[model samples]
Target: MTARVGVVTFPGTLDDRDTQRAVRTAGLEAVPLWHRDKDLKQVDAVILPGGFSYGDYLRAGAISRFSPVMETVIAQAKAGMPVLGICNGFQVLTETHLLPGAMLRNNHLHFICRDQKLRVENAETAWTRSYEQGQEINIPLKNIDGRYVADERVLDELEAEGRVVFRYEELNPNGSLRDIAGISNAEGNVVGLMPHPEHAVEPLIGTGRTDGLGFFTSILKRLVSA
Candidate 1:
């Protein structure tokens, strides 16, 4: 059977459509999931795309973590379902405590947007299996609160466990701790990252680089093989 992936759309989410396109491009059926709905529609995996949920009012993803859809995402993710969160979605995962650490305002105190280079630190995660360990690739990044921070103990634990899945290659655009750009859960079923892989999936669309296609394709292979 063909794998079906769900792209969630929260109230202010802006990348759901682009994420769906990336899903379909990876040869998987793209399912639309709503923030107010509690059902997952039996999708093999789920993706929480980027945007300012709830206008980034109280905090990025702070309010969105209470959305109905997230309840299900949290439960299923604990049950071993694959979940990938990008940008603001990454903020949600942190707010939900599914992933360790939290995002802070850019060290420069300004929203930054650009093509970013990242080194694949852990290629075995559900969303990064298609990449090679230590592979350097460029993905488009855009965000205001993109700096990732955690306590010293938590950061050390993540590093020791090999959960730091992606790291900034050459530049630390947001001044994230340890230059960490992405991380995965210990089980490798959940991943959160500040960069927008969906934005870099199409060669003709952005900077003519499809380096981010691995995120979608990696999950496809994971679900199909299972």
Candidate 2:
């Protein structure tokens, strides 16, 4: 069966369509899921595309955490469903407690937008298996509140468990804790990152680099083989 990947569209979401396109480009059916809908449409994997969900009011992704769809997503994710959160989506994952740490304002206190270099630190996650560990890739990152913060103990735990999936290389754009650009859960089914991988999937776009396509392809491979 062809894998059906769901791209969630929350209010104010700007990249759901791009995420869907990337999924289709990766040879998977792209299913559109709504924030008010409790059902997942039985997708094999879910992608929370980046945007100013809930207008980024009260904090980035703070209000959107209570959306009906997220309630189901949180449960399904805990049950080992594959979930990939990008940019503001990453903020939601942290707010929902699906991932560790919180996102704060960038150290520079400015919204930074650019093509960023990141090293694949742990390619064992469902969303990163297509990449080799230590492989470097360039992806676009645009956000204001993108700094990842966690207590010392939790940071150490993440390091010890090898859950740090992506690390900023060359220059840390937001001064995220330990230069962390992405991380995964212990089971490697849930992954969250601040970079906009969907934006980098098409070669004709921004940087003309398709390095981000691997994220969608990785999950398709996992779902089909399973």
Backbone clashes for every candidate come to 0, 0
Candidate 2: which stretches are off by over 4 Å? none
The TM-score obtained by model 2 is 0.99
- List per-prediction Cα lDDT, in the order shown: 0.94, 0.94
For model 1, how does the per-residue alpha-carbon lDDT over 1-226 read when each residue is reduced to its tens digit?
Answer: 7899999999899999999999999899999999999999999899999999899989999999999999999999999999999999999999999999999999999888898999999999999999999999998999999999999999999999999999998899988999999999999999999998998888798758999999999998998988
Tell me model 2's lDDT, rounded to 2 decimals. Answer: 0.94
Give candidate 1's TM-score: 0.99
Please state every model's RMSD to the true fold in angstroms: 0.6, 0.6
Per-candidate TM vs. native? 0.99, 0.99
Question: What residue runs in model 1 are displaced by over 4 Å at the alpha carbon?
Answer: none
Per-residue lDDT of 1-226 in model 2, one digit per residue for the tens?
6999989999999999999999999999999999999999998889999999989999998988999999999999999999999999999999999999999999999989899999999988999989999999999999999999999999999999999999999999998999999999999999999998898888899669999999998998899999
Residue 79 lDDT in model 2? Answer: 98
